[model samples]
Target: MAKLDLKTADVPKTREDARPPDGSAPIPIHSRARFSGWFGYVVLVLFAIISLGPIWIAVKTALSDSGTLFTSASSLLPQHPTLFNFERVIGLVNPADPRLQQTSFGKVDFYLALKNSVAFTLLAVVPQIAFSAMAAYAFARLRFYGRRVIFFLFLAATMIPSVVLFIPNFILIKDLGWLNTYQGMAAPYALMTPFAVFFLRQMFLSTPRELEESALIDGACYFTIFFRIVLPVHRSALATLSMLAAMNAWNDFFWPFLVGRDRSVQVMAVAINSFRAQQAGGTPDWSGLMACTVLGIIPVAVLLIFFGRKVVESLQYTGFR
Candidate 1:
């Protein structure tokens, strides 16, 4: 038997000192918040107020009478609050059956614009999420040639200004004869965004690899692992992403404005502008414009409210598991 040298004796590792025998990185220590005192709360309150100020103003102005908005533009509160602007903006929207649009005040009724917005937004969001999740799974789990280089390219794409793509994208739309079409508004956004892929990739990395390995041993394939395990696990993250994409699609202006030639497929954002422009064919209706803007924000705001906590939780998902 060989005797161990005293100088070369191995020391036993405690939980804290143990390193992975496989040479993988150690799991991090995730400490609970060492939260600050009242100062923290005060700071958060101040920040919230500052953030909500513009929204509050918009809502207030939307509620205010047009005469008041014109006469007393600086007033913080609506002295004589009314829903005339909202009512006008919601023209011909039937309470019993809301799908169909009828004519009353505006060129394009609100319900039709809303349906178009939903259609466009869904087109952009659903496929983007599906493909982004797949790409993200590949990035996080699969080992393939040029993976690093390809992912680097994807990361690098996000850094380029979107404005740079506008002209080229417009030309492509023009060439494809998709200009002023709903498909045109939806097509450019249907693919995976670099950030969405990146975001979901990071979340995927956080998921337990052991789960996948176990699934594989159970004769489950990649698709099964992705759909059953990965997607269900990261639903909060997906909701946050979907909400973000939907909001962008819903509130999108420049692209919709550029491509939207008529009211047939008009989204809320473009319709609001055209509505405002037509209303202001002579003089600008500031109250109506504000009201339209406020109305446009409601769906996104409601989504945030419902999923806000989940979004916050998912932000912490990328932290230590």
Candidate 2:
């Protein structure tokens, strides 16, 4: 008699025979086209109205002139729609007289601030994700001394309020002579964040180890495996992290204001503040302020519109893991 390799055995299963070991009936498949109920639809409709009502009001006000916006706050539609506010806030077009209220308010150069925002976001996010993936890979796969202790310290750091580190970061940046520079704005954030490292570590751990072992047998190094194999498999996590990093950098006010006070280097939030500071008299450029707010909102809004579904999938996958 020949000995058999049970490890390599293939077992065939039948649908009717796929019952639970306790012999409970198999779950029945139901049509996904069934209605979720009128109550569910009513709740969703109410949620949509609650979410979109404020945004519609903002858009309406942004399109109207200051005279109309202040007087007709409750108007469902703009009585008069114009790009005067947008052109004013952007500082690209000037009214006939530079002394005019709108033109004076317009001189803030929001376009430059927007450019700086894009550059800083890219510079910070790219290296941040790269470093995070490397750190996460080490934590999830490599066997090293004091790994648990070091990881615990990283987790502990997240518990401390970020506000607590502001003074220390400001002092360190000042000591390094990095104030008012783009490098100063981007450098501090261009490292692995604890949350990012933890999230990616969870993702890396869930990936199959056999793929890495196969690469090792073919004389591939860790870098090759990481770059060619691991990252490609986790693009969902990468996309999700990239979106999160972009959101943080895009909406950031305090840190950017602290380190980048220069006119040429100011981000969107600081630029908007400077624009508002000039409203010393007159009707107040509510339209221009609203337009700037709208401008600040567009990039992230578009990002969510295009990549929202993928990011949601990544979240679900992470939660399931």
- Best candidate, TM-score-wise? 2
Model 1, range 1-321, lDDT digits (tens) per residue?
Answer: 121221212322343443567767653422211123234556779899999989989999889866676676777898689886687667733554432223223444777788888899999889999999999999999999999999999989977787788889989998999987888988888988887899899988987799889999999999999999999999978887886776677777888778765788888878887877775446656776788788888876886798787656655533221
Give the worst 10-residue stretch by lDDT in candidate 2. 1-10
Instruction: Report the lDDT tens digits of candidate 2 across residue range 14-124.
Output: 445445578788644222212223345566798999998877777777888666765788788887787767776676565564435443354567789999888888888
Q: What TM-score does structure 1 among the candidates reach?
A: 0.73
- 306: Cα error in model 2, Å: 2.1
lDDT of each candidate versus the true structure: 0.76, 0.77
Candidate 1 ranges beyond 4 A from true positions: 1-50, 71-76, 93-108, 279-282, 311-321
User: In candidate 2, which residue pairs clash?
Assistant: none
Model 2 alpha-carbon miss at residue 147, Å: 1.9
Clashing pairs in 1: none
Prediction-by-prediction clash tally:
0, 0
